[model samples]
Target: MTSNDLGDFLRAHRARLRPGDVGLASYGRRRVAGLRREEVAVLAGMNTDYYARLEQGREHSPSPQILDAISGALRMDREARDHLYRLAETLPDGHRTQPRETVSPMLSQLLDGYTNTPAFVLNPALDLLAANGLADALFSPFGKAENLARMTFLDPAGRSFYAQWHRAAEAVVSSLRQATGCEPHYPRLHQLVSVLTESSEEFAMLWSSHTVYGKTHAAKELIHPEVGTLSLTYQSFDVRGAPGQQVVIYHAEPGSPSSQALSLLGSLNATRRRESTPER
Candidate 1:
């Protein structure tokens, strides 16, 4: 999409927000709605011309300082600020979009060696790339599914996998919505959302909310059939220069009973896979 698309998104949000939302008084009777560009410029300590250029799609690049000022003026939360940056990067100027690169073969092999722990690589869209044996087993909720978002939001087994499934589900859907606002016309993204909406009522309802969110640190408690309750801590590390890919590692606390249970799960997975391999 063009810079105009980003401009329109900002403008629409600007119009939708009541002056009161930003701590301004709502005066009676005005032709235009919400905070005016001049008001925002005053709040942000920016010149009207520069802010106007940004709003009209005439300006493409701005510094972090500028972004912070405008974001503050708009009363944007963390999620909205992130969306703003994503859109600014989408501008037709020489701004660089982060790259999506393949995970190193060594990393994939290393995950397999974990053998006893559940580990996988996920794209920003929550597509499952490579996962270990136990990871696969824990993911039976997906019934051998490929997309993480779909399994989490659309499947029954998925619902039962997480103790706080609804909360987890909301995060996934909200993240996707944020991604969409950042790249609204992304064809593959559009297809992903379209498929989920058509396949699941739960997804359709959340998608309509137009909510957005940023990912910080998150913890997950999953019920694995073999392991019982696996309380896992997840750390998401950015694969540098790989725009949308992350190295997500999960670990059960050492010396905890859950760790021993995970070992059992790993053993069982290996045995079953070995049996199936020869038979196949």
Candidate 2:
């Protein structure tokens, strides 16, 4: 990592906010976007030169209290605050370990038990490690359902499969940014980012934004070739034993048309599986 990575991250996030965002009064027309360096320093309760040196990469180490102050001054969310701490190398003790990517057999079994719900497990880099039958059926349109990032950006069916493709793209990119901060030394994460940046212009633009977000729960709309459009809400849970692995389960409102479509898709998927099996 470059010495200026922390500075660059701070600059990017600072440019994303305005004085009014943090309840600070705006003066005359500002020359630069977002909060000025002095404004941030005042808000963070630090000297202007100190904050400038930190942003200019001259300051190597910042205390936890200082980092927390900067985080609050910038109005960063939990994920973004964590990223800021990681960038400054001031992460709390026991928080710097690498995430274990392995999905346990029990977790795989839990995914299978979802039955009607579409559930899958993903690593920090968005690799789809394991998925239930419904998830497989839901993502069948993709040529490869192995990685959510790849499926959303590189796959032929990606644009059409997602009802809100742009939103999906933004979410994935921000999520990747969060992951990169959490695991800066992970080789696979770097590779994935490099590939996506080279392969997709949209991905490149979003990646450049330096937004950090981790998916917890969200509503999504997907179009299935066999079942048409389905509106679903997905919840992402961190696997207890597996650090980096997250189990995402998608469900539709009970008695809704989307729910009926999901049930139909599950039935069709089961029948297809049965038909493919040999009668021995």
Candidate 3:
């Protein structure tokens, strides 16, 4: 990574925020956009010269305490904070030291038990390592699904499948940014980023922002070909024993129309399973 990368990232996020975002009053016509370097330094409780040097890549070693203060001052979320620490080569709190690429059999079985919910396991690169039948059905729109990042950016159906297409696409790229910070040497991730950046202009733009995010729990809307429109809440868990692997499960509110639609899809899936099983 270039020395300017960290500075660029900080500048980009800083440029996106306004004075009012961090509770600073907007007084006069600003000569430059967003919060100025001095404003950030004041908010972070550090010297303006020091903060400016950091942004200019001249200040190399910032203490963890300083990083923490800056993160809060910048109003960075957990994921973004982690990214900041990682970019600076400081060990982030709760960052997995070991990144596993494969899912364990026990976890795979655990996923299968969630019959009513769509559950799948993904690696740092967003490769669909293991998925339950419901997840398979849920993602069937991307025929022969391989990687979530690829499916989201490459396939035309992705725009239709993701009801919040722009948000979803942005989040996907941000997640990839987080993954890149986690494991910079992963060849597959490098290839995926290259392909998406080359193919999709939207992806290229978001990727350039250097925003890092990880999927945790969020509301998602999907327009499924078979089940129609369904709103679901997804929760992501880091597989403790597996390090880099994350298990994501999707569910709808009980007794909701989306829930009923999911049930119908499950029933159809069950019938298809039975039909495919030879007489025994």
Candidate 4:
């Protein structure tokens, strides 16, 4: 929420690493926790005083060159790099308000109409903006819980639901890292990433990897408890004018058993909904 959210982010990364992680050799008498400030300064190729100044909010607007060095030292992912740059942009007093992003209504309706397929919309931070009924059902548990990244990394049963949980988890965290670059002033996103980076190693590892990716059509394999295995084609379309928004659609192959299963699942949901309604 604060302009310093990104600072908390940087410090969170530091706390996760050990002195030995960045080639720092420590004696047995070491009393402080985590890598010392000097060690990070060395790793970042900056003078200790400057690094300390940056961390304590005494300095602002570091050059791109310095940002890159600090990114490398922190092992920041694509999202983190962008976040570092944004955090670097500041007044001596520190007030930065990023524009609020919104999904187009037409795009939302398009997603709803893609009922045969499971389609959803997302912003840069991977926040679920809109989703069709089927997409809602397939990812309902996650959508209902609120945050996709949290569901993938922090949910115990959620991990078990995805057969390839590790790969999917990495992708989610890494994608979020890319988002940080695009919207460093997003308060909700900043909070979510802050909480995850602190608690999840899976998230931290991926965040530090510096990998980036945009949405693309992909075939995903999923194992639903009730339905067993499903193979589906997932495609993405960018919102007409929304720069960082995307509408992602998932379709089962035509005439494939997966398609049939999705139909059955939809029917089941409809029946459940009908039953829950009053007789009138």
Candidate 5:
């Protein structure tokens, strides 16, 4: 069992809840902002010392009953509950891991067909395996790293590119955590995690929270250096043949400012390509 991860997850979720939020009276000056450890233990219907031990990484395995109670006490949503169970290695269903990192030709063709959309494929570790022209243009500011997590946490351009930089950082870390949990033996994942943890305090803090999630579908606000701010939505799809690969496509509303900006970006890219081509 991932004892340290389980403990960290419990502590983070516990810290996210407040006494008043859980229908308890907030009396006396509190030392912390969130619910206390004893309060969580009481709500979880377990001994305070036992829960404390669990948080201290001394107790690894808790029964499904205890986990359920803790989930309830922490007010976890469906996704968060699934993540907590994963951290405890108590998930009912097993997940498939990526055996290799190659993007299929069919998937590549599909991405290429989406001429107007910014489409790309990523591995479990958020490494870019394949990208269409629009995506290449969109992510050009990230340089040639080809890894989203590293670019977000390590690259200074990431702060300006993602309008909601903090939200983007948290989501990337959470996604990485989910991926690592699914495939614990990926060496590159470990290396990436180690580097980010050691280099970026923000990444370190978010990693310690033990959040786990995939970027399925979400609205994004991005500030492109040339195109300006764009309000776009994206969908992430799992590649069935490749277990841990995801195909992500970004879209904007028709006739909206975002769509116009995207068109302008495409035009600019075409112009640059033409400029680079040799006259025959």
Candidate 6:
């Protein structure tokens, strides 16, 4: 999160593509790996010097049209394109502020209403802000389920819990990258990224890829300690009044084995809660 972050972002993404990847013809063996600056300039319909200036942090402001051209040239996805716009400070006003991390009482109550589903609220940094009973039971194997990124990379159980561990890791890292693009100056997010990058080699590798993504819905397979594997789909909703808070709810197909397993898990959680409560 420096003055040259835009330049760094451009460089990292530019290094990921080859001349053939973008339909550009190759003549001789190139010294560098990915597409050169001149190729990107040609693709984006801009001067090579202007593109180089943008990559060197010499150009501060870039128009939306120019960002779009660059995005198309880089073959960026929707999230990456938005990230590029954000990096260049081309977004409209009022979008640069830090997202609120606190979960509201109404949101917590909504989470509680999903009695049989695994539901939780997460902040911009992927911190677990609030969770319902089933969610608690779902993530009980982690022991420390405070942050999704931390649990996925730092905890040994994560690899076992997530059936597709690498996919999960990539998703987590890309989502964090999207958050970073939104709030580059957030100290807590920076701290979390630093900790994960230092602790986990996979995290560091993915972080350097400069991928950006915002999770809306996805299918996941989780292996529970007590219930075995559960194939579920989760939907993420942004909190109305809160900028960065999101509610994630997981559910399985009706009458499926995974659904039955989730029901059994819910029953087990309820029984455990009752057993722990004292007679009043």
Go through the candidates in order and give the clash count of each.
1, 0, 0, 4, 0, 0
lDDT by residue (tens digit), candidate 2, 118-144 = 999998999999999999999999898
lDDT of 5 by residue, 1-280 (tens): 4539888888888888889889887778888768998898889899999999988989878776777888889999866786777777675333223346898899999999998989999987889999998899998888675999988999999999999999999999999999887787787889899999999999999999999887856889999999999899998888876867888999999999999999999889889989999999
State the C-alpha lDDT per candidate: 0.76, 0.90, 0.87, 0.73, 0.86, 0.90
Q: What tens digits encode model 6's per-residue C-alpha lDDT throughout 1-280?
A: 8979888888888889998899999878788778899999999999999999999999999987788888889988867876887788797333344678777888889899999899999988999999999999999999798999999999999999999999999999999999987777778899999999999999999999998888956789899999999999989888866777888999899999999999999999999999999999
If both were scored by lDDT, which would come out higher, candidate 2 or candidate 5? 2
Candidate that beats the other on TM-score, 4 or 5, i.e. the better one: 5
Candidate 2: list runs displaced more than 4 Å: 1-95
Report the alpha-carbon TM-score of model 6 versus the true structure: 0.67
Give lDDT tens digits, candidate 1, residues 84-155.
887877342233253353677887897788766778887767777778777887786567667778788767
CA lDDT for candidate 3? 0.87
| Candidate 3: tens digits of C-alpha lDDT, residues 1-280 | 8867778878877888899899998877788878999899999999999999989999888878888888888888877887888788887544334467777889989999999999999988889999999998888889668899889988888989999999899889999999898777667789889988999899999999999878857789999999898999998888876767888999899999999999988998899989999997
Compute the lDDT of residue 13 as modeled in candidate 1: 67
- TM-score, prediction 5: 0.65
Worst 10 residues of 2 by lDDT: 92-101
By lDDT, is 3 or 6 better? Answer: 6
Error (Å) of candidate 5 at residue 48 is 46
lDDT tens digits, residue span 1-280, model 4: 6756666767777777787777778767656567677888999888999888777777776777777787788887766676677677732112233423676778778777776778887776677877777766677555354567877888775776677888777678767777776666667778887888899887888888878775545567777665667788787776755656777778898889999888877777677778999996
Native-vs-model 5 lDDT?
A: 0.86
- Candidate 3 stretches greater than 4 Å from native: 1-98
